[model samples]
Target: MDTTALAHAFTQACTREGFTELVEVEREAHGLWDTHTHPFEAKALILAGEIRIRTEDGTDRTYRAGEVFHLQHEEPHAEWYGPEGVRYLVARRSRAG
Candidate 1:
């Protein structure tokens, strides 16, 4: 699907799934982030370039334009951006008590 359609569909899905926040994110080329965790669950759709994420299990996976990745609340992970950098739309839902 095209970017517009993809974004629309993603938004609808996120809303249905109880995501309360949506945002666009961009990363610099060849950048890296040390392992971290988020208090909220996240779902993202890659829009440009590519990204590699290393999960707590040490498994690394690359996500390129048009792909999607998800992380559960407090799930430890690290990120690496591709040479051309990356952009994505992300939806986040807070963890319930």
Candidate 2:
């Protein structure tokens, strides 16, 4: 996928969807993160590389470039990047309902 193009499109989509605080994130290779929760709803688009997200229910899903993922407010999860690391665009919004 064209990461640069995807990032730009992702940012635009986030704004159109009423998401604020959009930002770019890059993780290091082989990075491992512990369980955590989001303060608000969040969404992200995978621009490059891959990530494995572990939900509170113990399900692990790996997302690669060109995929999107979301988390509800206060959702519990953990994530780690593949050996080559990952880059993505993320946006957050106030929770409704």
Candidate 3:
């Protein structure tokens, strides 16, 4: 789907899934992030370039444009941006007690 249509559908899905916030993020080319955790769960749709994420279990996966990935709240993981950098739309949902 085109970018506009993809974004709309993604937004709707996020809302239906109880995501409270949505944001667009861009990472610099070849950038790497050390293992980290988030307070909220995240679901993202890649819009440009690529990103590879590695979890504590050593499971690594690359997500390219038009692809989606999800991380649960406080799930430790590291990120690497592809040569051309990456851009994606992410939806976040706060963890319930």
Candidate 4:
């Protein structure tokens, strides 16, 4: 689909889904969840509040609502709620060899 068409499709999909929809989920509070390297890279968008992320390189960042960020495959990292708390949508895809 063209960009416009693809966007329309996504809009429809988002609107059709309920807020409390159940998707694959894993909750980890400081090493509680598995942190194995992902087979692919990924990205996440902050839908509400703020989020704090720490990378293996010792780098850290915070993302607020409407903000988007990326994660490279094999890059170790951890994510948590910022002072105001946060919720985000995480999108991932396996890397192509």
Candidate 5:
């Protein structure tokens, strides 16, 4: 599906999953790898391009458009993008649970 349809589907899924907010973000086409942590839980849906994610000491996974990934609260992880960069929709839940 296209970004628009994927965005809408992600919004609906977020609502069902009790996410309080949804945001769409676009990453530029560049090779960047960074490690970070988030205070809230992130449930994201890939809308375009590709992403490779690795937890601090866990397995790594590559996610492409139409794929979904979850990041838990305070989970330290690193990520890098494909040559085309990526566009994704993220839904955030305030509570750790």
Candidate 6:
């Protein structure tokens, strides 16, 4: 993966272990990652700023520092940050069951 492109999207620390990867992202403007699902478990932790994750159910949930979210691969979701952007970390682990 192009670390620079990923960085351009949002400044973050990305690391991979086997099929799992974790990324710490900080955005300065409204940012969005298209909706999709993988065969793994995904989690995002709000470190400083705020963001919202839109689930397939149309439920929108906001998270801030000290908050964490967990989603399974079967659960498709889209993500977006607030007007001021967001600072958070996302981690993914395989669930290709």
lDDT of every model, 2 decimals: 0.95, 0.90, 0.96, 0.55, 0.86, 0.70
Model 3, span 15-84: residue lDDT tens: 9999989999999999999999999999999999999999998999999999999999999999999999
Off by over 4 Å in 1: none
- Model 3 deviation from native, Cα RMSD in Å: 0.8
lDDT, candidate 1, 30-68, per-residue tens: 999999999999999999999999999988999998899
Candidate 1: residue pairs that collide: none
lDDT of 4 by residue, 1-97 (tens): 1434543443354445322221222333332222446655656556556667778888888776666667787778777764555555655655555
Pairs of residues clashing in candidate 5 = none
**TM per candidate:** 0.96, 0.88, 0.97, 0.57, 0.87, 0.64
Model 4: ten consecutive residues of lowest lDDT: 18-27
Write one digit per residue (lDDT tens) for candidate 5, span 1-97.
6778877878898889889888887777766668899888999999889888999888799999999999988889988888899888899998744
RMSD in order of candidates: 0.8, 1.7, 0.8, 8.3, 1.8, 7.8
Model 6 stretches astray by more than 4 angstroms: 1-20
lDDT score of model 5?
0.86
Cα deviation of 19 in candidate 4 (Å)?
Answer: 22
Q: Quick one: ranking by lDDT, best first?
A: 3, 1, 2, 5, 6, 4
Residue 41 lDDT in candidate 6 = 73
User: What RMSD value applies to candidate 4?
Assistant: 8.3
lDDT of 6 by residue, 6-92 (tens): 443332422343325777779876888879876777666666777888899899998876676778777889888888788766777
TM-score ranking of the models: 3, 1, 2, 5, 6, 4
